[model samples]
Target: IATRGLVDLPIDVLIRIAVRLPRVEAVARLACTCRDLHSPAFFEAAMRERTARRGGEVPLPSGRRRRETMVQALCRGERRDRFQRQNKIAAGDYHSVFVSEEGRLMTCGTHSFRDNPQPILGHSELDDEDLQVIGGDSVLVVPRPVAGLADVRVRTVATGYAHTLAVSEAGAVYSFGLGESGGLGHGNEADQHTPRVIESLRGVRAVAASGGLNHSLVLSAAGEVYSFGAGDRGQIGHDPESLFVPSRDRQEVTERLQLTPRVIDSLQGVRVVAVAAGAYHSLLLSEAQHVYSLGGGGATRRSSSRGRTSRFTGPQWTPQINEALRKVNVVAVSGGLGYSLVLSEQRHVYAFGNGSHGELGNGRDHSSTLYEFTSDGLQQINARIRAQQRALATTDAFGRHGYEVFRHSMTLADEAVPRLIESLGGVRVVGISAGGSMQTGGTGHSLVLSDEGEVYSFGCNGYGELGRNFDNESEELPTSVPHVVETLRGTRVVEIAAGGASSLAATATGAAYGWGRSECTGLREQVGERKSATPLRFADLELAHG
Candidate 1:
């Protein structure tokens, strides 16, 4: 079949078939093999999925040509599997989650040592109660049920170090696991074994939940925000010294409860759209499309020649709006251990906080304490860097700006100032997530999802985070997955997140999938000793869309 001439399939039919093949590289090969396959019809199908409105008139495609464009793009791009309609992922350290459009959730990676790892509802349908068990060193998957979660039905879920929280159709909050520092919102010191409602909050419509090493945050539907858990280093956006702490007596038990979810005083009027938590920091995307940060405030007051600038750096007990994003509208937000990623509706991506392993997706190799780079514009900068080899200039101790020769190119270190990532350009990115310090193959890399549901990975792939099928090969730039995701070639993905060393993607249909480090891949049995290069579809995920 490889050498055969075009199979005489109808162009639209052929385009549909092309979109289903596992990976964009396969589509490219198809186009290369047959002249008829290269027709405009095929190209149109590939491109349509990436777009929402033609002529900005409606949400659906305008005609057959537009549909063909969507199909052809899937064949032409490097990450064709991501553009397909049947795949989604949910990732984290030691464990990952996958929610399918069918309404089922599948998990893999590290299992809790206290109990054997199994699908959250694989043994039986989930009842109203939640479950808890000790965590493990490797990845484990957990797929809980929403049988009686609430009237609204569970729309999303979030996990923390030892806790889990979910949002319902009625806009209420349900949480379980370690309640230390009020992570469970029980209003007192108590670990929850079942789903419990957070009574303090009402009249909510949407919620964004996030967890840290031991802390957590919940952004309410009304744009108000609440936080709890270990406040050490102010992970809860409250004074660490004021929150609960262990007593000097060995027998004493600290409640570690916040008692109630409090509205971040300064953020009250600013409606929040999204929230992300790291080991000790948190980021919130506001209704205004602005990014705000809290906890782990550091010395980010760098005096640039343009102005005396002060930005969020280290431990903070209060929320502060990201000054750099004040002028831009944020469409998406994601993070790993200590960094954050913001994708603007305009297709611009800005990374801040940490960049130790290049999780920031910037092309630098330093730690950024503040706004560092605009990633979406990387293509232009890489082009310029290729044209010139001029050394980076420096300024004096007085903070005066001047040009001087210095060191190497920026890789993925955290930037005190926003530095434009000059590698990913022209390509429209819809989602992005960060993983841990594990450098599987690349020097530094980040996983990104496109508007068409396609996935692209850059930075490090030493553990197959790049989905390249190798653990020793690391890249310094975004590398599109060459093949279509065989399991989910026609699914639509809504968002993606990375945890510890694995990755997770959620579909508009509610399905999810995972890949990467075994302990964090959310699987029961390890795939082998090697990190997973391609995403594995968990059988239990088929239940979500049901």
Candidate 2:
């Protein structure tokens, strides 16, 4: 029997195959190998998925060729995988979660080391509730299938600060973890040891979901955003006044809690296709390729000269489109501890908010090596530096902004405006991540996946999160680290996830590698002598995902 090329297959059949391949790179490769998939039928399939998820009537300009616009939306889920049909992996503050090829949810990491653990493993508290093995004084857990969701076919999984949210193929949303302040969306503030469907969202099928430090966001297939949990800083996208409840600690004071799934009225007509929950803020993306931010975006006021004054962008209880990100055509957005990020359609990464520990990835952080000013004086100098950057907005070929050399004086500066990372010049990046620094001094690192399947890591490496190992143990890590992670230098990473002080990358062949603090990474001692700075594969992860 002769072998027919995959490209010779029907357009519908090719699309079905693409949808099942689980990675966008595979689909792109298929199209590359066979030019037949470039026909209008294939483009239409891509167009249909984009339009359906974004709720946009116009995915293309008036006169562009199908091939031209087709490349724009290719590679991975643009809206933070808001419309992704399936997800293979997820990384949290202290756990690694995966959705197997068979649609089973697999998890590994420390779950509640302090005796009374939050049921983050997705195992029912009733059966999996035994105290974890006590290795000395630390509690450790082994990777296993989520017993509570054993029968349900989970499509995508998201790991939050201390919580987990799983979306089913049938569009059901199940949550487990620390449920304080109503983060669980169970109509009450109760921790779910096992996965439980949010009854209020039963009628509307959720396409994706995200969990913040103390909040939860669920996205509908129709491009609507539903929010719950602590609305103290407006992360939930609801009226700030209505979020106040009587404080349990004091009767005279109030607290924050939104117990049920409430559609964000502010984003009603806007059509939000994705959501990203930071430590205290939230980032949302619209179908129109615009990014929106809310909650406590730090009040780092910077005065600009060319009408680019920066103030508190939002605490907008109501979600509003970011004017700075208006024309960039943002495809993906991520939030972390005191910082946020956006990936442009051109593969350029823009960062703003806080660069305290170099999360901005522009190769600088608020350090004392170059500056002798006090904290207050440092803020003033930073304001001037940002003001100067805003004066000249012309971008070079590599998205590099032209600015005065005064950056030397104020070496330690935080980004008030969405600054384009000049260091990542000439690389067409495909994916990006910003990990939160909930533990350690600061692990708010950033990782960018390039078109060539290599990863560029920067920001904090307090626990070897950068994965760029050296010959000696004490090689002296840089203050603002930004370079291609050594272990992943030659490897082709299909997906990546950053956590508190660890980093994870998935290869095309289904192998996963992680590096960072020992407690978080699933890597075992046998993976090259347990070097924290080197990327190593965990046997448990291999067995689970494989």
Candidate 3:
């Protein structure tokens, strides 16, 4: 039939032929030559064949609109995947943790670099002989599996500023890394270089766990919640009357140590099912689909309550069932820096807190509210700190970096209450994740997974956390990253995570992809200098023998 003409057969038959072709280039050439197969439908069907290659291990997305947008992207040849994925992924400030189906764990990136080197990679740095000092900074270019935990099967993992947590299938919790603020939950504030079970909660089966910048939360199989670490802003859900955390700056400093995991009595009989955290706040979900809020501190120092001042320059929000989300039927929640995301059972996304960098995804940012300071040494500098300059959106005043922050002129606005994202009204969202920190461009970003397995991102693109495919200039602009992640439209993302300035996605076929603000994550000098990243293979694998 092809000998006579490419269009001699039905379009469906032509599509089947194009999909079986081994090379994407071959499919591209054929689509160009045969006008009938050049359209989005044909391209989508062909690319979708990738799922069949996985032996139907994962299902296709459930939304037609998502399928169409994803296929259109595949037709444009925007995909570039070549590896498989792990069972689970947990992203943090500058590093990540991966748990494989084989019950093994691996981690990359670190919290320490030059002056005082620390091994927060869940492995030893001394064992790595070939570690390079590029541009006078130590850099971790690749991921390595952790050594311990050969006997236990890890089901989930979480990462914090300088620590890591692993929950075994047996519901046992293991922690490692920095011990400051009693983050390890071991009764003492001492760093654990290796995994150690929290002897205190050995009897209670922990079902889920989450970490904050300086605090942590744990949930029991029976619906009880436990919290520890710093509670200066009430992150450690304990009685305010008995709460006490050391704070040199605040005259109201408490005389108590936030050392061990204690049950949050307020959530008693509440049947809490899930937990999420950010730099200075935490969120809880009840079995009844109710959302709970706790802590509130970040980049902006504005107080939600008049004349009230707390740490991070705001009045602290105590743990309480959010009245606004009382009837929203929230299924999941995630937070970062000063903002939070709620995924409702109705496939709607609600955001609140900070919107200075567009983290809200409502098509509006605090650009209109930026206040400039004419202070000395406050030069126009890129907060993303890229090696090369991308397009710069006009702003009234630059942010604080090497200069004194108060000397810089800027204002961060708060959304105050959870509101539905009107722009995403048409898409059926299945998952939502948020990531951030105090970066020059606000660093907060949000990610949503459509029912069709497509990813949409908004907020700060200063660090490439949005992960938009730049194949077409019109579709993606680095200066203003779009909402939908076109590069991932074709892949059925089964898992996704957002960190301080990075994003991770795992496909239905078990392949993983990541992109975000890589500028000096405070661990590696080279990683901090943002640029189109592609580390030499040999260098990444040189110390692979370790």
Strongest candidate by lDDT:
2
If scored against the real structure, what TM-score would every candidate get? 0.62, 0.76, 0.68
Each prediction's Cα RMSD?
14.3, 8.6, 13.2
| Model 3 residue 319 distance off true place after TM-score fit, in angstroms | 1.7
Whole-model lDDT, model 2: 0.66
Per-residue accuracy of model 3 over 229-284 as CA lDDT, tens digit each: 87756666665567545565654334344688888887766766678877667888
lDDT of each: 0.50, 0.66, 0.61
lDDT for model 3, please.
0.61
Residue 91 in model 3: lDDT: 77
How many Å off is the CA of 196 in candidate 2?
1.0
Q: Model 2, range 308-337, lDDT digits (tens) per residue?
A: 445443345767667777767677888876
The lDDT ranking, best first, is 2, 3, 1
Q: Which prediction has the highest TM-score against the true structure?
A: 2
